[model samples]
Target: MKNTSAVILFAAMLASLVSCKTGGKALLPNVSGKAGEVAVVIDKENWEGSLGTEVKGLLARDCEYLPQREPLYSLVNVSPSAFADLFKYHRNIVMFNIAPDVEKQEIVYRTDVWAKTQCLIQINASCADSASVLLERNGENIAEAIEQAERNRVIINTLQYEETKLGDEIAKMIGGRIHIPVGYNFKKVTDNFIWIADEKQYSTQGIFVYRCPAEDEDPFTLEKIVARRNEVLKNNVPGMFENTYMTTSEYVVPGVRFLKYKGRDFVETRGLWEVKNDFMGGPFVSHSFYSKDGKEIIVLEAWVYAAKFDKRQFMRQTESFLYSFEWDKE
Candidate 1:
């Protein structure tokens, strides 16, 4: 009877939490932590034990494109009891609950439970052994979910910024619009290509917009996309020296996947790009989708060049703009 009552109380508490909504407090920007940072709620003993190591390896592993060490997400571990109001409102959070009596291991995800535009992933495990097995099986899914949530937050924040003058300009040129935040300029514009960039002292973030005729045959295959990208960059994106131009790096093959965002279907690609005959290179991410009319294939890409600092934040900031892609209403 006592156990049943306890469970009932817990359910009621969770229900209350989900029901209670804030006016505008929770919708505001997450000011508690930096971009790509996650708050981890777990017990200290477990955090210091093997479980801790496993969790760190999965979430805090090194992010690509940084010269020095930089984790994919900077993790701030907090004991379950110490998870206070500040941590509750963070943008990204992961909590683990372990119990010997737990029937099975499971992962639960919730959004806006405590605050708006927040993602919380909780893992319940029967024991340490179960926890290990569960993490090994579902670690990738958890990581991907966290990343998607972060991207969503970025889109929301950008919209709130309301820097639509550049977006409107791009919409006029490309027949579509994407949120372009302040501090970016139209570096170059041509018939088939456009370059917008936010140039900084030690880092440079930019976006490339271009389009081509949509052939009846699918032109989005990996081979076709790479060929198109190479050709576009070669002609429009030049380098510091003669015969030198930006091209996709042959050293590391680009990763490609299909996804649907905001009613638009896109083939997303992530890869390194290099300047031929030059020593400059960095990472690039692109979204290739067909225009609303189905007559043209548009590619919106964000790339980063930050030699002295961590690239994760820079990449996140620029890539967020890609998610802002929206079709203009006629």
Candidate 2:
């Protein structure tokens, strides 16, 4: 796999150099102006319109080699029976259209790199059947092109397969998961939180979460801890923390929040805020308990955040995550 990746990388580099020879001019014969240009046809007999505008956006962003906006050239609904012969002489072309009655979109993508052109047709439903057909300088055999194009289609479809698998796993664990909508600006999953059990110590779990704090709060202080806990309990309907926790008029640092809930001690501290402002908000809460007359202390720490989300939902999710914690016994 590593070697294959390396070869692909090298090939891409070589293709880029070849593509640049004519100052990035289109490599295939310019048929847009020629008479009787073969129009690539789409067979919508089995196609269902499942492709959404989001998929189109992804193609535009990820596959920049093909013209998307205003499409340099297009051939729509050319008779499918003639598609094979239409492009027999020309291997480089971009073809796209929605299937007749399908709810999703489908696109047939091909591009020229030097004299070799690769063709791939993808339907939102069965994207994996698409193949990347690589044609030699002489010409591409229609049968061989179709077979290879199917293989490439399968490769492209792997992405959807992995996504569906992960989505199923997440659905089994939690009520919901977070994902950026298709057209939104890309942002890292900073606000999402998860808890993972320690590898060596099966009973112990680390609480991992991120937050953007309010301007007045310092994430590391005891005061912040009390305030956040109280706020969480108030807004989160299923929260565990209640009035049993006492707010302390003390500070691990000045202006920091401190609190003790039940028998567990907690402190909140601030962190570097990256997105909204110069300062980012962060809170680390943990339970510390003593065994055998306070001789040994066991501290279980968790990161917390209150960022751009529904407070009730965030609290509920955080509470559920926190409840999964368990102490490891030696």
The TM-score values for the models, in the order shown, are 0.86, 0.19
What is each predicted model's overall lDDT from 0 to 1? 0.81, 0.31
Q: What are the per-residue Cα lDDT tens digits for candidate 1 across 1-330?
A: 533443344355456455554434454444356779899887778899999999999999987644456799999998665565557677788877676556757998877766667788978776667888889999989998888888887788778776777787778878888898778888888777888888988889989999988984888888889999999999998898999999998987888999887677899988888899998888899999887778888999999988777778888778888987877887
Local accuracy of candidate 2 as per-residue lDDT tens digits, 1-330: 533443344345446435544554454443231211123333443222332222223222221111112221222334334543455324333333322233443333344433233443322222313212111111223323433433333333333333333223223333322221112121112222223322122121124322323344234444445555434423321222332322211323323335454344544332211112123233334443332233332222333334432122222222233323222322
Best by lDDT: 1
Best by TM-score: 1
Look at candidate 2 and tell me the lDDT of residue 226: 50
